[model samples]
Target: SRAEQSRAEQSRAEQSRAEQSRAEQSRAEQSRAEQYLSKTNAQCLKGIFAIAVLCHHMYQYSGLFRGKFGIILQALGYLSVGIFFFFTGYGLIVSYQEKKEFYIKNFLRKRVLPFYLFYLFLTAIYALWRIVLNIEYTRRQLIQSIIFKDALAANSWYLQVIIVFYIFFWITAKVVKDTKKLVRMIIICSMLYCVGCFMLDVTSTRYESFLCIALGTMWAVNKKRVDKLLDIKGLQLFLLSIILFGVFCSTYIIVDNLAIQIFSKMASALAFSSMAIIFVFKLSGRAEVLINNPVTQWLGKYSLEIYVIQGIFLLLRKGTKLYIQNPYVFIVVCVIGTLLLAIVIKSVYDWIVRKCRPQVVNM
Candidate 1:
């Protein structure tokens, strides 16, 4: 009887402790969801990936990487872009869902205008450089470059592609009253484009990139369900495999003979980006120190400026041979030079944002 009573007490105590632990875990999960819903870790992730892209560009010209190292660098650059494209879609919808009022004009004024201003600023800087050096760029050419957005930047199509996605998102969000349907529409559209790519010889990176974005938005839009799904051990492993497969797909050249060629399977890119976002969402708390470090925080804070500024400098590197010959020297010069310019550009951007629309600075 004494032994039985002791075991009974032990069971009750264990059950009570388990319940409390479950409650604490639930609270922690909710807190984490809120953080992922916000832009802090988003910025940190952006900063980290943008730096990867920056190095990819620098190495492209530096004669630094050869063989598999080169492939890895290329994959880093491309996959980083894939991650970015997904977040752009995910973040947009996440913000939109949080809003009481979805004002297109206000969104454009706040988000699109700042980007356009930065692009113009970059164009103006390039134009001034050409004029000062008497390198002979036509005004028409400059205007076209600014309008078309591929004249000088290392990865020129990114902004243009994203803007199109933004516009399409707004239009579709208006039509689809339900978030689920909106996500479905995007998936259908992506599938159609992929079909064209494989069957019609129409390979448009924009469509595929939009697919990645769509998947991201889908993840965010279906946050509650997906979060629960992510808790499943089997599902997590499956998603992880999908991500790896996607990375493998993104690495191979699609056009080569003996290549799998189904566009190196953009599906891989889509899966990898989607899983990566979920992974980051899950790990945001653990990486907070690196995420919130002063330099990294600054980098994360001003990632867009860094992205745009580095592209401009890399373009100059190509034209002016501003790059150093020695690998170490080149890396130091590029990394420091890019960061410094990015910092300066960010300050200028802040000033402009304050002067033009002080209200939007925080928004």
Candidate 2:
């Protein structure tokens, strides 16, 4: 009897060891899976960022189509902002995931400085245009416009919001390492937005919608929930397309009546952005074949510069009315002209960067 009891105890011990080994192996596999997902997440989002912005630009400037297509384009424009925010959050958090020690100078020099330089350059261009057109300009207005204060009035406030959000995100992310705290920060910003609405005396503009997006991005990145969405298939995409079209049509129908209402842009922005996130998840990996093409990827690299210059091109066209006989034709010419100019400028910029790199290394 004693021998039998000892044998049974030994059998139980062997079973326990096998279970432990299996559990460890499972954990190892999960870790590898998470690492792979993280990599794919970043790559997938980069293309989405490019496409979403492109969609928005097309809707805004290309009046080639009207009615349902127009509404769809406009909705896409809304979704583009959300896609950008998601990428921004995912990218920034992932970058800092390994290292928490913040370098203010490096961040400013690399990330923020280029934007300031571009802002100044663009502001100067606009100032020259205003002078040529003999449009009355106040010094204060010029300063505000350059710094993004007058963005609400300018109709191109996204740039201003981007600058502020980048800085805000960098600072908050650097200071608050805890994921839970980061989420709280987002909630706080959102609450402040609500309070600002109730007070009505608050000076912040609607362009500050970046706050919600920043929070959303931060939350999503830390949660590592991208895999939850990996199984989104074609049927899901088709359904999403239907829902997006439905909201877009309904919104358009009401837009004329709501022209004067404050929430028009905000509501549209929210609805479209939601649809965009869903659509982006469906479309992310599929674009790799196209975006991976050398020329396309090169264009994608310089796309942001193209985005900044597009408004200027439009302003020039509007002022000249050079192609106004047919708005559709004019839109086509404007797009082609912008792309050509963007390529030329990017080429020159790349050349300069390449030349300077060798000299800087020697120094």
lDDT (0 to 1) per candidate: 0.68, 0.55
Q: Which ten residues in a row have the lowest lDDT in candidate 2?
A: 258-267
TM-score of 1: 0.80
Instruction: Kindly report which residue stretches of model 2 are placed more than 4 angstroms away from their true locations once superposed.
Output: 1-64, 103-105, 132-136, 151-156, 194-212, 229-296, 320-324, 344-363
List residue ranges in candidate 1 displaced over 4 A.
1-22, 33-37, 130-137, 154-156, 189-208, 242-262, 281-295, 320-323, 352-363
Among the numbered candidates, top TM-score falls to 1
The all-Cα superposition gives candidate 2 an RMSD in Å to the true structure of 8.3
Assess every candidate by TM-score: 0.80, 0.65
lDDT of 2 by residue, 219-289 (tens): 45545454444333534654765575466556656767533232444444544444544444454445434
**What is the alpha-carbon lDDT of model 1 when measured against the actual structure?**
0.68
Q: Compared with the true structure, what per-residue lDDT tens digits does model 1 show for residues 325-344?
A: 46677677777878888888
Best model per lDDT: 1
